[model samples]
Target: MSESPSTRHPRELATAADPAWVDAFVVELRLLGVPGDEIGEHLVVLDTHLRESGEAVDEAFGDPREYARSLAPGGGPAAAVDRSTVAMAVLALVGVVLVPAALGAVLDGTRVTVTLGGVLAAVLLGGALAGLVLPGAPLLALLVRRRWVSFLLAPALVALGAGLVLLLPQVLVRVPAPLVLGAGAAAVLAGSVLLARAPADLVTAPGERASGGGGRLLGLLVLPVFALVACVPVLLVRLLG
Candidate 1:
């Protein structure tokens, strides 16, 4: 982010003398994966310094982004984000790949068909989506951050592989349909529970959650959405069969 001079606020802003600098600093820290609470404490320190020194923020702090980096270079207490991202990836994998196989079995009176290419496609697509949600992963994250074509192209490539899995004769193993369905449903339920305990859901009070209402709404819909995904294949199978 570019550095710019900003006027100092007098006492009312509560965090820092320069609102612009303070905003940039907070944003940079969040992008670095610093936890929300820790960022608040850091702001208090900056405000205290500014009050004592009576100096222009730009003169004293140099640049907000640089200062934030110096304070939180490795990022503070974001294991939650990383863990949530992994849970999301697992949910994606089981929900997409296993459900379709189970559907194939129940609808066609066959065991759940599996292929090497299908598994790889599921993993890559799942990982890529997870990496987009939380940065710092290799390849996918870099591609997204840089606006590289991988962000646009990865899903298309995975789709191509999925189409080939249906067309080509490459059976890896056939899992019992009922067993696959049971296991996939259980895993998805477990992952949803973990997601419910994620940092976003840990926000204190109904009012605070309302502040991020869209995210909170999505969190509320998780169970129903998961149920819908599980039921979709069954509906498709019945309709098409």
Candidate 2:
């Protein structure tokens, strides 16, 4: 009698829980273009059904190729691409609009400096999308693919945004009050736009790779407070220096 995929090797699951296998499944799912929500739902279903059936973790996830086939059927990769473009577009919008606008307000110098930064961030964002996303179009074509890649992408953006947040105090402390307010305005605005375009699948959907549920909202609320609090350090730095 063959052991199930989940239970195939208890010893393996005991150590790393088969990170490579899970990652491969996630990568394949992304290639198929399943909606993030649906992917999460299916994973839950797979996990539950497999567990109930007495399958081990590794065994349970063994048939992701089959699951992927079941999802696409005759539609193939082209179908997946069509489904992905909208979300992709939204992502592009976040890069094109939000990033530059926020940076513009903060880094205003002569009109030249402001315009240049705006242009640079926008161009870089566009390039990142094209480089990271477009080439993978076939794989990313699915309606709701929930891959670690997609999930991880958001935080990378957030991390970039966070850098700006941390930088604001240093910049503001040295600048005039009007410039400080402008920087704050820009930071807040850019942050908001990034939040608005944040992919729901990445954060909200279960079984998808997410840092936390409600985390974006929590960040939304917390960032401003943190920014305000950061003023103390900025003031101190200025007063002392």
Q: Write the per-residue lDDT of candidate 2 for residues 68-101, one digit (tens) a residue.
A: 5566535335333342444434443443343333
Please identify model 2 stretches exceeding 4 Å from their true place: 1-19, 44-70, 73-109, 113-125, 132-194, 197-199, 202-213, 216-241
**Poorest 10 consecutive residues by lDDT, candidate 1:** 201-210
TM-score between model 1 and native: 0.60
N/CA/C clash count, model 1: 0
Candidate 1: lDDT of 28?
62
lDDT of 1: 0.62
lDDT string for model 1 (1-241, tens) is 2133223221233444677677677666766666554565576666678889988788988887788778885533332347666776577567655665676687778898778767766666665666656554444435634566766676777677767667655888888999987777776676666665564422121112213435545654685476667677677867887
| lDDT of model 2 at position 230 | 43
lDDT: which candidate is best? Answer: 1
lDDT of each: 0.62, 0.47
